[model samples]
Structures are given as C-alpha cells and as structure tokens.
Target: MKLYEMRDRQSFGFSAENPSGSKGGGTRGGDCEKLRPCIDIQPGETVTLCETQGPGMITHMWFTGYIGHSFILRAYWDGLEEPSVEAPVSAFFGCAYDENFADRDGNYPVLNSAMVLVAPGRGYNCYWEMPFHKSCKITMENRGAQAQTLFYMISGWHGAIPENSGYFHAAYRQEHPVQKGRSYTVIDGIKGKGCFVGLSLAAGMNGHNTCWVEGEAKMYLDGDRYPTMNYTGTEDYFGGAYAFGNDVYQHRYQTFSGLYTGLYAILGDTSDTYNHQKRFLLYRWHVKDPVYFDSDFRMVLDNLGWTGPRYDDYTTVAYWYLESPAPTPVKLPEDGEMVMK
Candidate 1:
C-alpha cells in the first residue's frame, strides 16, 4: 500500500458528483456556476459531513467559514458512538482566538504546520492521514446564536491501511480561573496505549497586572501519580524564553512556525484590567519526540505565575494517537462557559 501508488479516487463533498468544474454539463459558462453548494446549519442542528466504510485513508480536509467556539466538529472512528475527535471548529484547527482579526493592511496572526494550516484567507486545511479499517463518520453542530455557513471537502483514497498505524484522537478541555497553587489538567481519563503528539493552548489572565508565563507543563505516564516528564515554564514548553522577550519578531530559537513547535498569538491590551486580561495562544507538536505511554497518560500545567500563585482561564486541545480507542465523555462546556470574554 504505497502512499503515491495512484489508487482509486473518492471524494465526499457538497458537489453533485461532477467530473469537471463546469455547470449544466455544457462547455459554455452562462448559468452554470452552481458547482459549489454551501449549507446553512441553524442552532442545535447537526449535519453529517462524511460517513463511509473504508479500508482507506483520509488524505486531505479543507474548510473555511465563520467558525468559532460555538460550532462543534466531531469525528467518529469505526462504529463508535463517542467521537474520537471533538472540539470547536476553530480551536481544532489551531486557531484558538478571533477568526476575523485582520486590519486594512491584511496583517493577521495565524498558526500553520505540516499537518494543519490556517491561511490568511480564512481557509482552514488539514493534511492528517486518517486511516480507518471499518468505517468513519464526521459531523458538525451549530451551537451558537446565528446560523453557520460551511463549505468543505474531505478527499481520500481506497486502499489497505497499515497494520501498526494508530488511531488519531483529539480532545478539548478548559479550566476557567485556574485554582491557586493547583495544576490545570490538559488531558486525562485515558485508558489505552497511545503517544502524545501535539497541543494548542489559549491562556487568559484575570488579575490586575498579572503575568501568566510562570507555569510548567508536566506529563504523567503509566499510572504514575507524579509527572515523569516536566518542563520549567509555560513559555519554555512552547519553545520560548524570558516571557517571549517582547521582541515582536519571529526568531528561530525562541518561537516561530518551524518543524516541531510554535508560538502563534499573543493578544495583550493596556486598558482592560491593567493588561491583566491579556491572552496568549501557544502550540507544540511532538512529531519527532512523542511521549509513548502503555497503560495511561495524563498531562497538566502548573498555575504558578511570576509571583507565588495565580488564577487564569486556560483552554486547550490535546492531540494524540492511540492503539485502542480510549472512550471519554464528549461533554462540551455550557453555552456561557464556551464564550470567551
């Protein structure tokens, strides 16, 4: 099963099985521009994006629209009721903050990687190789106030997936106003064998003139009560030093869109709460160095700031690959809790 061996083509999208990009099955272009059909999902309605029995791999997924935390995207593997991948549409693709954050100059901050890329034109793309043996299902829900217009495509090929390939999993969690002297759990309730791959975080401070970079990331493996692997601070885990240095420039060593890690966004303000309500978005991928766990895995981040302890709002989506499906509750935050202040 070579990757580029030219297999059969299979695409599930909004199109009506049109071979060419033309409309009305004619050569001319008069009223044949209905090639792309978009859907409007009202609140509380779930729309099935893709469902197929496969011995194939999903090669590419591309979606772009006004997606936010209120729009939930879920993916199910095999015939499981629980979704293996569930998160807000924006956060799932590594865009944690505002979607429309561009000025007249068209300068906007975004995060991009080999697997996930959020382009400047609001095009969200995913190139993860999701291989399933029995079946695969993908759905989207509109949990927000206004209706959502979605235009997307899921393209893949029919072939036998590799034997040792693990199932991909992603979970979104958050702890509002992190407790003092306590740790915020990024991922937990795992009951399978998997390797931690990547994580994206959105941190917001709630205190006046408070600093949120004095935290550390910890990973507990295989029933260990304490973390076997721990880092010094939050910024350090995201490939930064000295509170990101306020350089306002992307550096190689500090943090940028490289191969393994990146610091995507840092939204700070001087007026609100004396800059204590500022927010930061950071991400790290364990592509080269994955945290392998056999029995279970848990990840946490310290709430310690610069001076003693602190409290803040922390939200994250943890990405991993598991040998067996570690079914966890797909409980999302309430409508009020999901909204970012």
Candidate 2:
C-alpha cells in the first residue's frame, strides 16, 4: 500500500532502511547528481536492470539513450522464465526504424500520451501499472556491436499486490513487405483474462506508391473465428482521415498529436519524391476505454492499399494486462532477426 522508488541515488537499489533517507539520495554522502554514469553497456550480455522478491507494482518507468533495434528490454513476472514484457527499447517507446525521433530539426516528432510519452530529449516514459504476486525482474540486452550508455529509472511500490490485479505486458513485432492475402499480427499468444490498453504502429511503403493508407486494423478476442473488432482503415485507427491528408493536400505532410491518439511522424521529401516510400509513426491509447477479454486476445492489421493490395513494412508494440502468467514462453526473435535495418 505504500510507495517506493529505486534509483541511482540509493545506489540503484531499493532498501527501505529508513523511510526518510531517500530524500538525501543526491546529497553529500549520497551518489548525488551523478546518476548511473556507465562505462559501457556491454554487448551480447543480459544485464539485470531491476530485481525484487515479494509482491509489488511497477508504477513508472523512464529511459533515454541512443536507442536502436539492437537494444532489447524485457521483464519477467513471478519467476517465469519467459518474459511477460519484451520489445526493442526503441519500438516499445513508440518510435521505430532504429532512429531517434527527437532532434533540433523538428523532423522526427515526439509523442505525449496518458500511458506513454517520447519527449524532446529523446526520453521515453511509461506509466503502466504492472503488478506481480511473487517477484519481478527486468533486464536489458545490448545486441549491437559497440557499447551504448543510457539513463533509466524504474520505480514502483513494493508490498501486497491486489488479488484482482493483472500483470502488465507489451510485445513488439515487425514484418517487412507484408505477404499477399495475409494480415500482420500485432500481438498474439495471449492467454487468461486481460484488457488491451494501447498500440504503437510504424510503417513504411516498400515502393514509390502514393496509396498506402487503405489498410485496416482488427482485434480478435476470446476464441473468435474472425475479428471481433474492426477498424475502417489504418489511418482511422490512429484518428486520421482521407489518407492522412496525403493524397488530396499538396503539403509535404499532415499530422495529429493528441492525448489518446497520434499520427505523430511523417517522413517525406519536399521535392519531386513526394511522399513516396514515406515512413510514419502512429499510436493509440485505450486509457478511457479498454478492450476487455476473458480468455484470449489476438490483433491483426490489414495490408490492403487503395491501389490494390500492397506490401509494406510494419512494426508494432502492443500493451495489455493479463490475470495469469502467459501460457507459453515469450520467445524473442533470434539475434540475426532482431536488427531493424
């Protein structure tokens, strides 16, 4: 019932030795403003980010770095070998393509929402409440060639978790040149009761086609033979209309960034290239309204385009909560398949 924070000021450990001592973290005797100054974030190694035995709920998380697809973040709940949450740190934070969405040029735009935010300083923040009954473990893996340093903070309350509380989960998936007559899986392998909370989708056209916004998203819940929930089109799912103002308007780009939904980023050249092979970063949060599921859940996105079926690259991050641990291990892609490029 009480709140606790684990940060570098406390030697990056959560110990409730004295309730009032945390305020002194950045003081003279404490570690001070010198937060985790990393010499190296080693490659091909899994570093334990946070581990705590006993029940607790992870309330907030923040991370900033030169994130790429090679950096993977994972969290295991209640001693489960398979991580309940797994995604590339970049994609998980709602940006993809192994690129920083923050810069002085204002080309790559940052997203701010109720559940997740990618800020101006390349900072990523999440307020998903993750409850664990037995233990919680978080880890980061650097799959890149060189060492990368970053700043991060994961703080939550440790004590008795609610009996009805569900465990938080997010998954990352990507498909290049989506196959013909098939839908892209956003998140699957879900079991037990849960509520779908949010989705982040990034896509890029494979060719110089202008009609790549006709795709629709679908949600399948609880053993449904077909999708129980369907969207009109991909742009509609992210609260946009009319090809995201791509076809009709002569402008270089049109975007919408709001509290619940964001058509945040559009990559295009202002010259003769037009919006060809344009890249986009979009997100939607189901905070005010959650999709409740009893037994299972699966989500998919259609690849149909206006000019006929089209193939495009798709990457997504799905956020949800489940009553029980996942039935099977959440296997991450192999090292060779993890690169974003």
Candidate 1 lDDT tens digits, 1-341: 48678756454332223223222432233475664456788989988877777676777777777667888888888888989889998888776665336522335656678777777777878776787878878788998888988877776766577777788888888888788789998898776887999888887777753456778999999999888989999878888786676433542213366556777665655344444466666778888889999988899998776677788888888888888654553467876677774
lDDT tens readout by residue for model 2, 1-341: 23375432222332222212133443243544543344247778777767876577777877776567777888899999988888889888888765534322355577878778877767788877788899888888888777887566777766666688888888888787678668888888788888999889888777656567787889999999988888999878888887778767663347778888987776654344754456778899988879999998888888777667777888888998888866332466765675544
Which segments of model 2 are wrong by more than 4 Å? 1-35, 100-108, 247-252, 268-276, 327-330, 335-341
Best by TM-score: 1
lDDT per model vs. reference = 0.74, 0.74
Error of 2 at 183 (Å): 1.2
Clashes of 1: 0
Each prediction's Cα RMSD? Answer: 4.2, 4.7
Worst 10 residues of 2 by lDDT: 12-21
